[model samples]
Target: MTDTAPQPIDLDALPEEDDHDEALTTFRARVGAFELHWSVDAPLSVVMTSSSHVGRAGVGLIEVLTSAEQRGRTSQAYWRSAVGERLRVQGSHITSDGGAERAVIVQTDAVSGLEVRSTVTAPRGTTALRIESVVRNAGREPVVLTAVSSATIGIGRSSSDLDRVTWGSAASEWLAEDRWRETPVRELLPDISLPFHGQDGRGHAGVTSHGAWSSGEHLPCGYLVRGDGEALAWQIETSAGWHADLSQTRNGGVLSLLGPTDLEHQFAHELLPGESFTAVPVAIAASAEARDGVIAGLTRYRRWLRRDVAGEALPVVYNDFMNTLMGQPTTEQLLPLIRGAAAAGAEVFCIDAGWFADPAIGDWWSTVGEWREATARFGEGGLRRVIDEIHRQGMSSGLWLEPEVVGVDSPAAARLPDEAFFQRFGRRVQEDRRYHLDFRHPAVRGHLDATVDHLVEEYGIRYLKLDYNINPGAGTERNATTAGDGLLAHTRAFQDWLVRVQQRHPSLRIENCSSGAMRADYALLSVTHLQSTSDQQDFLLYPPIAASAPASILPEQCGNWAYPSSEMSDDETAFTLVTGLSGRLYLSGFLEELRPAQRDRVAEAVALHKALRGELADATPFWPLGLPAWDAPTVCLGLRTGSGDLLFVWDRDAAPAAFTLPDVSGEVEVLFPAAPTDGSGWRLATTVAGLSVATSAGLGARVLKVRRG
Candidate 1:
């Protein structure tokens, strides 16, 4: 909390430089409770180790393997031995932002003529450190980089306390998403024997994503928890593929993070004499208090990273997609929905898919280009009337667009050149009749630009739902050294295009969706506005996904759909609305068919959401009943916002519902629904453990607003 204002710290002025213990050179700094230490092999820069959350004693706990590969050898970064060559430190320095933010820079050069600059930064008021590495070609000849480390952290050697490390990661899919599991490290590397083995560990455990959809396969984030529950959590922020591996080192364990590598991602890029490439940024946060503490650090960092891009207050968005029309919408179907959405207090009314689908075609997926209004489906001037109606109802008009895909049966498939599409082995890459567009091509950009411009200018649209459905594996090898390199290049190009589009239309809001939560990568989320939490049609099964979304995405930006139908019971309607009110409220379903009571419930939920929206912007998430299990009958998610804390609880099986929340001395009030349904009331009492609540409304949910006593 010094008034230093981010000035450079002199690296040579430190008192301990001349007074080194043995051959290891130590550089240390205090960033809150976290102590960051970096060590160098005095004369040779071959071994530079960096560790964070170091205790008061400040011993070397983490180790990073810095040995250079043999000349022209295709050795992967984490899977190689540190015996061939060594790297020499070129320069080192530190800087501070005058607050709690500080950064340490270490520059090194390899004998193979490769220059690497690694920077580690700890932002203001957080226990997390962000690391990024830039590798440049310093030689006269072309050098191929197969694997490069983004950031690495080491924990313990052979300590029994560390041996019980448990790792956790999330598994995702189209409907079932955010399924997290924690297991012992021994189970991950069972074959690797323990005790006295060289300086490095026997094996490693990690999760890797291989395509543009970073979270499609496995979330690029995880945690390592000791037996006592003290944990260190980390996340890799990349739109393309990424890898994070944890392996036991001589006296500890090392967690190494990298973008796309040759082994897992088929990534290899050639660097010309003066060419340079920067690895994706990764962050590791620590918590001594509890597991939730680790999540809090990451949550703060996620908000900090989005400070620049997350513009304005997020409002309730009603998209007529999942569970509602299901892509079959017309002028007749949308007019009533638009009015109903506005009446339900939606800030934005988005007409989902089938707007451009040919009326004659039975399947709309194949004919998904041109981005034009389907006049046949919506009588003459039908679509325009519905859009104007939405605007007249005091709501912003929105549209859903799958811009990255070109259906094989669409006219644009024949219009755009083959070079504009992803190619492998000189042939176009098509998955399920859809060709992926390579943003590196100008034609692809031009098409999407014109589409967006027309949608915004002609229709007066203010919001857009940008969705990607298919994954074309790695990437196109056309005009690139490797498929992964091309994919990464294209991914960056697409992000750049999004930036330009946003610049052109500063007021326009874009929602990032990938058939659900697949492509919820920071590379896209950082630039976009809202993220679709999941596409789970079963409202009962969506609590876990909605509750855990804050772990990966910001709460205000998590667009959890609440599609309540007339067929649902009163409790079911309230349950669904609670899910929406808990997050951004991506509203949907047949609102026109609902009873007056149901409509009032929906309207009240939207009102509660609007009231909570401002507080949600600064809220930090907490799990009252632990991280929700996918099939848990009782689940609760709490958010501590500026005004107060709000706890959302859902009872699925209609059993006796009781929840013990975290310690919060206060008077709790039901903020949503305006009135209790079925004349049932909630029982609230304070206990030694925490705030305990019991509810008589079976199979229902509620958002309780806390007023601190």
Candidate 2:
């Protein structure tokens, strides 16, 4: 291997020009694999390579320079080599148009020896260029390096005339105090103009620092910002080993790439003295749905990078037949109950808990992983009978399985022996309500894989509600030392098993539940379709829960609704049903216990939700009204598709109180669900021009449907 470094070429002597001209000499352009000398103004040239492995086009490499004068305010540029095969660039430059200057620079490295190659294309009539980078590393040594793709936008007369920037991701955050992480792009920048600042005084309020890696106390990374003025630009810097940043400035907002820092740290490789490493970064521009399209495209790219990850699709609705129909009913009994629910507007008949071998188990503390049919309770082939019954009723069957825990007296405990479960200090470790399973153990994973496969293939179960009853303990060293890779491996393996199972059935859906909503995370979201919002089933508690969820998630992925339990009042039940109607609704009650009139009320509520599912999915709730329960009357309003909309109000006590609505105007219709018929009856009154209400306080329960007139 040669120890000599390639001679550094000085870019200071490059010429500056407003446009490329044929007279330009000293500049070289290469397309695909082949290289040829050409003038600056010449139509883009094409080249082919020798290796069929390189395919028809292989990769594209271009090197160009003008007189140093045209380079503009050239900032810092330095070269460093840690692995000996790649060259890293660290610096910034200034570009100006119409007297406004913007900073731009390349934040990563260029490599010649790469497991994967990339292609670049620039079509006419587009303001932004496109680059596509693909890598497939099969070497013993992992490849480790940051990929920072940068672009410079010419300052225009107005920011509105420029392309808008939008990002696609499940979550985003600003580097606040190094320990802080925020979700949802809107929260990170409540105001579009204020830059988001970090502890080190590096971020601006309206600006978003998309990606970063901590180097002890300092953060080396990239950020993106939208330019409402004229010019927009960006920079990415990596100090130690790996980093990534994709930045763009358009009319809407600035979108960029963040996180996945751990991927670079773990997978980057080192080059032998004489070997070479290559890196490619791509950027594409679309005029419509830019953010969604970009995010979707990036998701596809990441999935391809991770070996084409695909999740099972299962859509379902929750209802009260499980607990009410026949608590732990036999297969013969449960089948009809499930069929009844299917006929009563349930698309997926979910037989929640209490269906296994032991009813004595409480709080999920025992009987997990028993995976046996309750022959006494379910009759023979009970599970299969229920599944078949659901299919016959024109619906899919979903069964609950808490595979991450085991009971002290479970058959699995005796059958697998102590070595199979997680242990600490010679004692089995317990968490929350159950004994934790050592997923790090291949044997444990194998057991779950076999069980799930059997359930899916034998019973024709299309939806599996996999519940985890315990919190993860301090993982074993064998798993922890893997940099959470063991946990990630367990997750990937579980997903891989599901994928294989899905390939066979092709209609399986998986819902992940971990002692309610505690395990809600990106990793889980990537694998499962729906998440159990929380164990708090009372419908009255949903508003607070829904509000708190935005702190960590998007509402679309969150499951919340009104569930009528045996302990609620008539007024409480109406409130619960109405509030839950605004979300992904689920029910848990005794259908037989309801009076005929009450049953009709529930049917109407369910029907309303089914009809407005599209609107609810897309609707955003305005600020809540009234104090918690402290205020006499509690009200919540959510705008539907039209400008004038619906209002839900509940009166907790007997006293009458005044209320106000914000951001609303014009005529309104207030429909009272219930009210007193006497002279002391609830009345319709208005305190403001845009506000009006119909009263029914004496009525046990009421729904005032208000619309602006």
Candidate 3:
């Protein structure tokens, strides 16, 4: 925590020599709990490894692709490029980022005039290293970069170790999000016995995201572990395209993380003379203690990255969207919901989509712009009346907005010029009959800024639910060399615009919802107040998502939806409430239509959340039964806080049985189902190492408070 910056120690044994000599000079620097080794030689090689790691071998420092020098080896592809091996080390130094120590290494390729300054950052008190590269064209001519790596590090010491490794990452969809997959490394990459042939393998196994929805298909976080359980987990923090992979090299097996490339995402960046391009930020957390430990380290880093979040400054929100209005909102439907939400202790009431739609205008699906209130919907006063009702109920009002797209038939589509929209090949990019707006264009930014200001100023809103529905493949060709480059620019501009909007309304809270986590990357979370975890309507399917989301997102930012309807039994209603209690507790469903007991259940859950939210904000998440599977019968999540810890367990479709929680012996009580005579037979008792949970069978859940003695 001291202001004294870290110094890089020279570990090279050889004496000083000219750059022309074949002699090697190596240096080391300790960043947080990790060590980085920099070797200055013919081909500059840098290895970032856990300080406690048994091996120090790793791949080259940089893997870059230029228009002239493509892949050096078909076998190495993204792992090995001609320019990467030709770049000679210029210098290495230490720097500081917000008081935390960092290291920057400089390398240059004279032929291409690509000067790369790779910066390594260690967030204080976390075992993660944030890596980035800034490539400047120092030559007299321009250089087109087809690809560049933010981080390339060895994950294995030898071929045998590579085969024995295991890896896992989360796969996501609209309703089914954060489904984790773990498998043997051999399944993804086959060992070609490189030592016998003295060659690096050409083929690689990797995950690449295209289009604007960064997490639409797969999350940008993953991990690799060897047989002894030494593990490394990483996350690429970008809202646009990203790539990460594992491949074989002469030195060892390396994991290369990058943001957008010509070969994959149709991304190309042209750096003119004296100009520079910075690669996306990627981070890695290593743990000698393995999978769970590295995941914990990654969680801690995610926390440190967004420590200035203002979500806790806001109040719990109740939106009439999931399993309720479903976008068909009117005066009759909303007044009752608003009253019920307020009665159930919701501090903010959000009216989801369709508020501005005039059903008389041909269903108004593709004509949703204008943000004007529909007079026919609310008896002349329209949305203002609804907003008034929300205010009268003593709750702040919020609205849902898909700010990045304009319906093709909307007046905005014609008002904004073609330059404001994303266009490729002389045509606007239209997906699902909606045109994606390029945030890089000033007109687009102006329109969104005006829309946000009008909504906040007119309605006096305290919260905004910003949603993105379309994934415009690649990006526009208006102001960039490639589609990927344009996407990168637009994403950056969008985040900047978000910052400006927050500045305009300092007390306002923003929620990032991309059709439910299709774009839940850190670029948005780092700026926005909260993230909608998923759009999953079924309560039966949300436990796994809520349980596993802490691996990549902070528990405080997870916006798990809880919609309890009159159709659900008392136990069923309580089950969904537990899911909401796990995270930010986004409430929904028809509370006004429920019976008195059902309303009491909702009220009790909301009350408990308000009491424990202070703890949830600073707590660290852990799994008692490990991370849950999609259909796992029993799922348990524990939150360790400065105050007594909290444990959440779900008996999904399992018969009434007993399960054990590890390393958690304490005074335990069911915070929910506070009254024991409710006939659920759920009891938490102390065991030798932890607690024994025996709950009533046939789909039930519990919220238990644990005070360790």
Candidate 4:
């Protein structure tokens, strides 16, 4: 503890010897906006504390639990492990480049021979940092790692007031995705009276995601907020399995993050000598601006993570799947839609699913994987004619592809080797009516590689909606140590394949869609150009998903569907169109069959999104009405831009009312449905405190442009 501000010092530079062997030697370093202080004493730890506020700083830097060794903690929580406490710090240093500062700390458990090289990178002008660790089996014998930490840090208000903090988490599903809830930390981890008993609490609060959907059931992101306007946000970047926990550590609250664990996901890695395993990446952000500001910081961190992958122009895409073709697109059905999409201002027309199946047979779910045109369904030039028609209309062509699965009835099932499929207990992994392919296998990779190449070269396709519809449970144990380790390696290998595909065809745009937003994590979005935010068809349910998606996904990458039909009222069409306008507009439905007014509305929405999308690329998303709840009558999402702010408001059965929006002022105007009678009805005025928005009730949404004066 120092009275004056601490200065940068060597992390391993121990202080003068003290009489007590357990005496702590404190080291301090400024990493971006965070002032990290660590103790190079017996149990190595790091904490974010500075002159303004002191947070929980005594967290064990890393934790590794193995099958043979004793469980780290007496409780089931993955913290305070014997290995974590015993691991001695080896070396550490800091490096700066590209407006970010990075710190590398290496440690090893001499008995277990596990060497963990942990890195923390903070982007300039942001109060957040990205943390990840690579563990290597430095010993002579193999070790079955049951659980390894990707990020282990302490978070909360001052140590004494930690229990007062509240945390927000997400519950995701196929149709109902991005349902967020905020609860007090005490509600999950109550008061165990650690000081009275002199022991850390046994019970813990946490979130875990299993199977292939990195964001299924629960998103791999959450936030902790203190009453003092201080906040900490975190996201585990993985497309496979992930786990995060919040537990008491006597130092306040410890947030432990891991990829997969034997205790939870049947994931155990048997690391051989010299072989290394890099855990999934996790980003942690801190802010004095409360929950929204912390999320804005994470948005910045995500951009920093995608430094190599450039942001693409947000194109209005028309897919013939939702509420339209329903995945059974025939040449007769798609030709008119392609022409319609082009006329309605869609830059890309996608034929979603059923392109290679015969509808006569019905429910072709069990006969996919062979990416070929079904000759009988399409007339004349077949699928190519539809694609050519799209090109002739001055729009790019896109196709739906589920490259990860092979159906039981498909010819590809017999063509690929058994080694190419996920093997568990000597049998290929089957879920629903399909078998999951092991991308690590050359045979499997080659098959998909050729399929993509054909689509890009022969078909002249510019966009691809790569959809993943099934989860193969635990992972393949074919060529790996344990099932969990295999799953982790398999996902990582798939990322490599995506990189190769993008490198081969740099101009092509690949969309990341996993049964909707199930797999919308940074692991895939970092490489892919766009993310399908959800599969929810009801426009009423979509506002929450689109408004809340930016907490873990970038606003520019959120491909929220805007499917409008001829039957919908003008107001209803505007409602759905505004959802798409909130992020990257994904168009669909029967645009060609719509009345002139309805069709004109869709075109106008596309034109508006195109004009304002440049602001979306660098904008920071905040929820003026708080993170959208599934049943919230009114939901609001605000994106802070350089010139001003763009506010997206949704009203679903809420009384015609007004709620104050935060940090927005100056002149305001309705951007979409520009004319009052065109469809939208809204009022916006800059209040003395901030901005006031009024709207009509019953399923109406509006996008307002706010210019700060």
The candidates, ranked best first by lDDT, are 4, 3, 1, 2
TM-score, predicted candidate 2 vs. hidden true structure: 0.55
User: Could you give candidate 3's per-residue lDDT for residues 1-709 as a string of tens digits?
Assistant: 3333334344352223323232334445666666655455444444444332322433565788888778767754477678886777677676556646777778898788889988877887777878888999999998899888877776655677776778888888888888888888788777667888888788888888858989989998988877787888899989988999778755457788889999789999898999999899888888876777788788888877776655565478999999998988889899999999999999999988887887567466687667777778777677888898999999999998888889999999999999998889888999988998999898988888888898899889888898998899998887999888999999999999998998889878999988899999988888887889899988999999998888778888888899999999988999999999988889999999998999999999999999988877777787878778999989988888886778888888757878888888878878885665656477667878678877776789888888877
Q: After superposition, how far is residue 605 of candidate 4 from its true place, in Å?
A: 0.7
Q: Residue 360, candidate 3: how far off, in angstroms? A: 2.2
Summarize candidate 1's per-residue lDDT along 387-429 as a digit string, tens digits.
9889999999999999999999999999999999999999999
Q: What would the per-residue lDDT of candidate 2 be over residues 1-709, giving only the tens digit for each residue?
A: 1122212212342223213332333222232222222222221111212211111111112111111111112311100112111312233232334322222222222333333233343222222223433333334443433322222112111223223322122121111111112223334323323222211111212222211111222222212222221111111221122233221122222223221222333222233334433332323232222222222232232222223334422233553332354335456556545654554466777777767754444343466676766655666665676678788888777778877678876778777756556554565666654566665576777787787777777776767776654444333223332222223334444455545655666677776555455455434444456655556544444444443332222333455445554455555566666655544556556543555545555666666657655544333334334212222244453434344454555544444544555545554443333343455544545455445444445322333444556
Clashing pairs in 4: 72-81, 267-484
Better of 1 and 2 by TM-score: 1
Error of 4 at 220 (Å): 0.4
Structural similarity to truth (TM-score) of each candidate: 0.91, 0.55, 0.94, 0.95
* Ordered list by TM-score, greatest first: 4, 3, 1, 2
Off by over 4 Å in 1: 1-25, 29-85, 98-106, 190-194, 662-665, 675-679
lDDT of all predictions: 0.75, 0.40, 0.81, 0.82
Ten contiguous residues with the weakest lDDT in model 2: 51-60
For TM-score, candidate 1 versus 3, the one ahead is 3
